[model samples]
Target chain A: MSDAVVLGLDVGGSSVKYRLASATPSEGIPEALAQGTVSTPKHDPVAGLAAIARDVTALHRLVAVVVGIPGLVDEASGTVLRSANLPALDGLALGPALSAELEVPVGVINDGRAAAVAEARWGAGSRERDVFTLALGTGIAGSHIVDGRVVDGAHGIAGELGHVVVEPSGARCACGQRGCLETVIGAPALRRAWNRAGGHGSPKDLLSAYEAGDARAARIIERGAAALADAILTLLALVDPGVIVIGGGLASAPHRIVERAAALVAERATFHRVPAIVPAILGKWAGAVGAVSEARELAGCVVGASAG
Target chain B: MSDAVVLGLDVGGSSVKYRLASATPSEGIPEALAQGTVSTPKHDPVAGLAAIARDVTALHRLVAVVVGIPGLVDEASGTVLRSANLPALDGLALGPALSAELEVPVGVINDGRAAAVAEARWGAGSRERDVFTLALGTGIAGSHIVDGRVVDGAHGIAGELGHVVVEPSGARCACGQRGCLETVIGAPALRRAWNRAGGHGSPKDLLSAYEAGDARAARIIERGAAALADAILTLLALVDPGVIVIGGGLASAPHRIVERAAALVAERATFHRVPAIVPAILGKWAGAVGAVSEARELAGCVVGASAG
Candidate 1:
């Protein structure tokens, strides 16, 4: 038995996760030798990265490692340019630093892009060639996967779907833009939309209310779906992919939301080829799967590792 | 003079364009090819394809041939699933038919994606690792390029920027979706936007008036830029490319429009590294250049073709 193993790490605004696993090409299970999550160290990216490296190294013997960060990263350069949520990590040579600490080939990627890689290789998106992953987390950011390659634009930023404006003069986005889709569709957007719809409750409450036939809740959900659909439809018109994978916390929304969003998209999209909208299959382990997947690829494994 | 050449055809909704005598890759001239544009056959798409095949075969001696269609084309399967503008050509075996007709290797691609190929290789987008091309025509469409390859989603549809809704409830688009950016940002949108601003005139007239400092004209231009900028910024947050090349007729709008849009994006996009917004270097001929460039790639030249 080959004793080769790779360590995958997913770093987010709130937490950092790791998995030690063995993988091979054409396999999906990256047999996890160990797995765990920790509160991001110090909320400072550099400290956070160092802490993550230390923890993962301690857990297992790894042949290679990969990290997924939550900000603008130059995957080609292996650096984290900046992240508002994890400030201390800005301008850090994360890949090189980790490679030095762990004494193995290390890789870094955008969390969303990494998740897309996971999906493309081993998840629902495996069926299609071009897949756009919309991570409806605390904020809405996305990754566009074309030809099995994630789009890292000229400046290493390409899939900013959340920032696409859905309201010309609507809500003020954190980026200072008005009425971004992220403002209307992300978790915070859902909350605001619920509030605007005259509700005083969490997203779950509003969703439950909507499911129970409350017109106001229904209206909020409808509005959010419609806005998201508009964005998705536009994406369809631009890049008619076979399917769209909607992930993150928002994936918890009822099938009705996804259906309605798809309907809205089908209604506006003209080119006839509409992408099927589905929830991401990777679930909570998407980051871990993606991170290890990247490591394996860096190690010249053309196939996927099985999940533990 | 190694007079290597390829026949490039851009099959649009209303017409078919042909270019002949392209220069070799070593030669510096972007596409040293003579050109021709003839009305697409007045008959249906099947007949039109036959017509194109006849024409292409007539010119097969040139080297290779490539056609850019306006629909959902599965380049791998060589199937045209749906094309709203060219309904007659839907579901045809474009590559097989043309390849058989010309008795040579042929390539078929989406018009916008083809343009991105051209721009990425020979146009202004040459420097960026991942670049996006936004085409503002009778309707708006876009293409994404990553690692010098077109971003074809799982279904061969990836760069549908126009359909993205900048306004969720703004207006109904031809695709049946309301508030799509194309509904308000393309030429038709510009015309409608100009009219809504209290002017009954063509886009050219409105642009002239705006250029002359007419308040109404200026407002229209300003509003268009603002809306467009909102879209660009949002995209920036999704996929931070190094640069964005603006194409289509509307790009001819006053430079102020691009500047103002950039300003709006800078203000609002917070999460991702922003890229510079620049005018398209390849003009109307971008599609042709891109078509020829794709054909050149298929023909396997030593040096890659130019994109711009």
Candidate 2:
């Protein structure tokens, strides 16, 4: 029974989330251990990680530890190649660093990929063999799940959907890419869009205005939907997953935004059956649940290694 | 040894190709049994299938058959739901039909998906865990291989990359959709592009001319490359496959066209490494080899079931 326990960690640009869970695929998310907060060491990610690790190690008998970070990670080599937000994470062997500190096997995954795993396992994509999960958080990201396995790129840096150029000469993204959908749809982008439109409000407020039929708010939601729809349609053509799970803070917008995005994707999908566009089921627990799932996966790898 | 042989069939809109191979993965491609042509069924469609059954029965024995067709195939149910090209195939239980005719179990798959399986197992993609095979033929189609398995959609209709819209209002496609990459990059579109450039040459002749530095041919190639690059860059954002196998007739273009297309895709990729673009080595035999691979997979399923 102790082997079923796992420590799952989701390290965001501004916050750190963790969950303790039973590692069995059928086991429900453990409720006994849960802790999270806005990471105070954003300026010094290693310090923040060390603090997080100190907290995580207190949980008894972890089967494995899993962490998802916002960056290009070479999982095979256990190196964080790059991330603008977490500068200290770059070049760090995150898995070994945390593993040494915690004295347990650790598995590292891309945050988007971890979210996709959560969705594929228990959310809208539960029944799908192929699934795409989109996270519209502070920045946009996506993960491709095929046949129940994440499509980790050859160099272990897959699912960088946020940086894809929708327009050749559009806005410049912080990633040094122009016309990226992230610039047009991410949370920061949403605020900028609202400010540019002369609409003074937060995204939630904008959603309320949009519900009240404010033309500017509606236009803002429409633009977000259109950008999301285009990317979804493009993904539909390639991945053709059964369901698309839209998560992150942006997805909490009014119903019209999700409806419009679904309609647009449906309209453009030709050769494939338009997949279901649904909100992710994990909600606030997505990162934590995903981390536990990652831990379970790593446990399997460990068992396989020991057997071999 | 004959008990190890299975018939592999690849059905297309206008033609049918086939292969005969042993049931084991290591049996590889049997050179002597590689046989194919445009599938011709004289008289009634049922009669045509009977004829194919007879030909296949005459050539192989003792293992299940695998068929890859251009349509929406439910592999579990052994049904072809909607097929634009083969009206005779719609609503048909292809597996039962072939099983009844040949007295053997059969597995059916989408041709595009089967092509990816072939590549992942034995062709250009064998080296990578995540690879994509795109066939730019009469239609622009693709299949993804992630961790050595095809990501069959929940409904078995994933990998419809051609149907994804590159332009919201670009061109009408045969699937009753507008702006599909197929409408802009397929063979007919490429031919029209060549014609629009006032080049009175076949695809072959145009390739030679481009190799020899013909301005008109170069322009046409450039246009095709742009469309293809746009579609590829978009897909890269979603799947982030390590390698993309460019197959089918259009890939026959001289090295320059391929290089140009690669450069365009690379230029558009963001943050992540752009996938390596290369021609499929299996050429016309890809579908046949894929069919054989599918047959082996199906036979394995049967053996596994019997064992269980």
Candidate 3:
């Protein structure tokens, strides 16, 4: 069973993380299997991913591979529709490319949804039947999971809660919309708010200032918290998940954003059941863990169908 | 088979509608089966529902009964937790009571969700895998359906999109919140807005006046339409349904609210897929139709479990 392990890869803008796990993830993580990371080629992510796959397979007998990419993916066809970070990989058949190079079954998924899958299987959402994970970093993204399965929706883009318009006239978003939740709560938005308030600092510095009781930092943090609370309440009204796992850079900071947002949600959610808000425990390896889970699920389905 | 037909009851504030559907709803409406309505007793809705069930069963055998009510319902426990209009029925075990009297399996659902089930099974949402139905009448309500089944969420109140806050400081909502989607888009809200603009007329009259290019009516309609568009776009970013069915009295009016909403959504949706916004076709019988569908699904689940 140990010899039949699968490889999971999480490809980001600057680096790619990889890990090996047993084909069935629920059993436990494989012992002493070294997790690895390599710098991603800025211009050729597909080739970079194939190299990583080769390096991982050199030491382990890989049965399957799953890659998590930051992009709009057509999972059914294994195509990367659009990736803002890795633009060169746009329109590429990533899964097929990797499978042909590595000679194993391959799967691909959106990175945000991958984080949700990871959380659902091994993090804060593990015990819940329904979970919504919001990743707040340079950009905001989300994933909705029901009964341990991520809802891919009709177009495979169901969990775009970050783009939901919470303010109709606030700020312009990268997606060309105004007042998107991301426009107000994304990390850049928080930094921008702080800078506009006569504070020149990174998001981390801003959080430290907020913790130190800087009035301007508190005001910026309050605005972000309010926007996040509104978005969470909107999600509660729509998705009604059991637990909302907050992940990424901004939420993981010690600024108490999640606590403040939770309080605001409790205050406003009179007719709806307020969900438990907690931090993501899987950390940076969430995407890799979720990719492995997806590979295992795919393998299980194929085996079940063959047996039937 | 006719003797094994099921009965669906939709209990409203002032009346109850009953229909006898075949054990399977996919086969289409039963030919010539009498559908009836009776005035509901002001103080005893359970008794009124029981009487309606008896009346329907008198002509046709009922193997199962499903009731749709306007309130918070615990579907699994067959309890009505709260009802604003039918206060007397609050906290009553309506499903068990009706099942005991009618001698059949019973299922209870919220009326808004019932409308969603009807649309998903036999109306506008029939062809879509993911559908969000928004019922805009006396109050605004919604249901999120994924792969032909309604997502009841963790607390069984997942589709309360009507309560999502659209404006933070706009208007007070009945749910003790300010600026809820219902506060701006419900029929009563539109009426209030119209009346505030120096117009005294029914909702129908307001629509007619808007159609005739009355400036005040247009202003009111524009406000309502914009608020509705914001709510719909919020839903799209969160739920990402393939189609959105607009139902209830306000939606079905001849003033083309759905068309206007669809246009607004198209104008604002840049990155997200704008779902097809259409009016529901089931009309007044939607709740009854949905109740029957739920009963059939419930019956099928029982049979499957027992056989297994």
Among all candidates shown, the one with the greatest DockQ? 3
TM-score of each: 0.77, 0.86, 0.92
- Model 3, position A164, has a per-residue lDDT of 81
- Cα-based RMSD of the predictions, in order? 5.6, 4.1, 2.9
lDDT of 3 at A6: 71
| The 10-residue segment with the lowest total lDDT in model 1 chain A | A299-308
lDDT of 2 by residue, A1-308 (tens): 13446777788767788877655555444453556655636665555666676665454456587888777777776678787677878888888877776667877777667777888877778877767777877877777776557765565555666766666577898877777888877778888888888888677777778888889998989987888777766666565667777887878654566688898877755556787778888787677777777787787777442231
Q: What's the DockQ for every one of the candidates?
A: 0.49, 0.52, 0.73
Order candidates by TM-score, high to low: 3, 2, 1
| Ten-residue region with minimum lDDT total, candidate 3 chain B | B299-308
Give model 2's docking category. Answer: medium
In order, the candidates keep a fraction of the true contacts of 0.85, 0.67, 0.79
Model 1 reproduces a share of the real contacts of 0.85
How accurately is candidate 2 docked according to DockQ?
A: 0.52
Question: How would you encode candidate 3's per-residue C-alpha lDDT over A1-308 as one tens digit per residue?
Answer: 23566778888898888887766545443332658788987776667777877777676667777889898898887888889889888999988987887777788888878878888767899889899988888888788888778886666667787788777788999989988888887888888888998988888888888888899988877887888888888888888889998888777765477788899889877877988888899888988888877877766655431221
Give the range of the ten consecutive residues with the poorest summed lDDT in model 3 chain A: A299-308
Query: Candidate 1 on B22-50: residue-level lDDT in tens?
Result: 53454332544367778886455545655
- TM-score for the first chain in candidate 3 comes to 0.92
- Highest-TM-score candidate: 3
What residue pairs are clashing in model 3?
none
